[model samples]
Target: MMKALRAALLGMALAIGLPSGSQAQTLRVGMAAQDVGRLDPHFATSTIDRVAVGWMFNGLVRFPPGSIDPAAIEPDLAERWESGADGRTWTFFLRRGVQFHGGFGELTADDVVFSLRKSAAAATSAFSADFRAFESVEAVDPYTVRIVLRENVPSLLGILTNYSGGYIVSKRAVEQKGEGFARAPVGTGPFALQGVTPNQSAELVAHAGYFRGKPQIAGISYRFIPSDASRDLAFQNKELDLNYGRADQTWATRVRALPGVTVDVFEPAELAMLHLNITQAPFNDIRVRQAMAHAVNRAELSRWRGPDVSRPGQSLVPRGYLGFTAENGLPGHDVAKAKALLAEAGYPNGLTIKVIHTQLPEMLNMMQVVQQQLRRAGITLDLQVVEHATFHQQIRQDLSPLVYYSAARFPVADIYLSQFFHGRSIVKTPTAVTNFSHCNQADAQIDAARVSTDPAAQLKLWAEAQRTLVKEVCAVPLVETLLVFARRDTLDYGYKLVGSMGLGPQITEQSRLR
Candidate 1:
């Protein structure tokens, strides 16, 4: 069925006389996922969906290939943009002749308005919290978009980069496809999502009308091979050109030694942390929360993850992100101190906490290590492990008292602090994002930093925010794990691997499978 679907999609490409359709190479790639969660750019929160939607969409601006630095943002759908004197308004000039996939017609300001508006609406986007400052998005003309913010932000360009809530969708395509758009998305990117074969695989075809130029490869065969052993075997058997690698020292080292294989370990690293719900019982007491913090051994967790692909987490805000600070003054690992705190919190005989954990290999492994560590400190985790997708749903529904979440956001302190610690982002709320800790202690500092024009002042506020979050024992910072990927040496990504916001190696028009 997967092969037939691929063939049918390719047949349609050939029938339409797409450039190099008959001879262009199709790069076979395997991912560590059961299946894609959502392809709608507005709701593509999972790594698998991000990897797919990224190829099928473009934003007003984009982080340069192989970089996630804020300074490296370059024009994409919008050729040029300028900010108002007050820094509250931004005007973007859309590129002419740019076309959307699936004959959705030319890219215009109307689509930009619709996409941005949709991204800011809580009902439509998973990342709507990222756009809380947006007052309005208006189509000034056929090729001009004007965005007004309620207050000054750290970087307006940051919000326009090709990331969560940034990818633009065609107005006509979105309205026409409606909910079906997740399976069949339309955008102005180098590749088009041709078809999805359920749990099997997804087929992408090179967009002949791509503004950048026709893609070097014919397309990508994105396969969902969840098992490490199965995916590794398929890659070794030369059935897959590339595959997501286990992001541990052992796996990375072993894979790098394989014949004709190259392993890439790149940033920004995903920060794994234990969010203790302060609003819940047991954890409602600050002593109990501190006990959990002291129970965690960040160094041991980092060592287990392997120093080659991970580092001990220093702060709630991920390292390498702007405004991050290691001077958070968190409680270090001390089993004796942890036990004392638990006893003081009226859990003298230790406490059993129920947690809903994800069964995803990397996440599960990390959580298992934490469970053992907690057990040593007189805490037993009654882990109710579920499939990854179900875990996400249940966690958001506030079913988990202890949420061990690992994620990488747009390398910014504001985004990280606001989404993870803001009051408005508390889970089970009308405007919820990912405040698993249900912490609002640092709201003042976080809010102050967002509107601060002075860079030093913003950094100071962010530093204060981190310290407050830590002092309040909102979460126990664990380890920062880098992204690991193994690929055939014959494949050329056309650029150096460094950092990717898309959570995977991005295939561009220049990438080739030779």
Candidate 2:
């Protein structure tokens, strides 16, 4: 029956002369993204980049397949690991017989050391800070690795399990490919990179010698389709086996009603936030930042996409994060109080601040709502729109007084606080790439938590950091969006997908078309 349904859909698609699906065993995935920013595992910044890298790489530790649980930690390349009683030293036992792509011999302790050390390099890697606690990484033996930290390093496994810097790459391949490796990455995973056609698509073929097992599907073709409507059309015509769905509930509900279509909505998610640059004039005044924080109506913002599509954000940490709380530290909407604060800040005549955001539709809608709401509080939001990459570039250069960022990261509190609040991360400075707000209030608390051996104490420290940001009004949290995806009912993900950190769903050796 599933095969018949797929055949019918294919017939309709070809009738219209659209491109057809791939071979029966080759699953096609359509992403609503412009391009895969970078394929290098160490520098994959965007969701699409992570998606491609995940297919062909393995991390020392990983979140269990299809499990979105923030605390889910499992062995990936490292079969098992142990840490010293003091929690400063960790040793991992690498799984033997794992072969790198292109038959680059077997994975060993040297590849693990080279991959991790490179990821921690401040001069080159995009995620250098995550590995800041690492004092050293050494190959103890051919299949053994040891990591020693300068401090206790709370939740050390969590750091190694994160998607960004955790992927272990092939040392031999990197030495051979050099700069060209970005286009042709080699890893020891269930699949191997066949090739990529620039901004269009990436083709991956299954590895017969994959350590876990051979992939059920023969191959996968990832298509980069940026337009929502185009993705919908392609999915309907069976040109794509799956699609990254829209954020608004209307689209999700409509898609679910279609025969042989199933829609998945789950969390934890990326927090959509507005970052105010405190270094700037008006924002430098606490009263002005407080006024801006109070001016936001989270309920009103989530209404644009329906409550089902987005959760009204409460804190710096989202629901799935370890330190999440109901009272997230920001004041509720109070226009009268906001106006009073504006007056107190000597902006009674009203202040106009420029905010730059990406071209995504849901973002524009939310910003429009923000524009009207801030007007009621005597704050004019001068909105500027730019493409996604350009928006990230502009915000980092300190160009926009108010910057909008929506990201779903590892469920770690210190990671969030450090990236956005740590002074060392102030973009355009010597070291960091984020931290649009030049915030330094939580440095002490964040540092204290980093070395704490007690879990409860560490959590308390993280929560304290959130409280400081709330009081300082560094950034205003608005909404949390769940990852929503639609697929042909005939396709089987093989694993139970509760949530994911990769671009869409986890397509592993088990996923296949029914």
Give lDDT for model 2.
0.80
Candidate 2 residue-pair clash tally: 0
- Candidate 2 lDDT, 155-254, residue by residue in tens: 6777777377888888999999998888898988777777777667787777767888767666677888878888899999988888888778789889
TM-score of 1: 0.97
| lDDT for each residue of candidate 1 in 301-341, tens digit (9 for 90 to 100) | 98898989999999999998999998889888999999999
Candidate number with greatest lDDT: 1
Error of 1 at 104 (Å): 1.1
TM per candidate comes to: 0.97, 0.91
Best by TM-score: 1
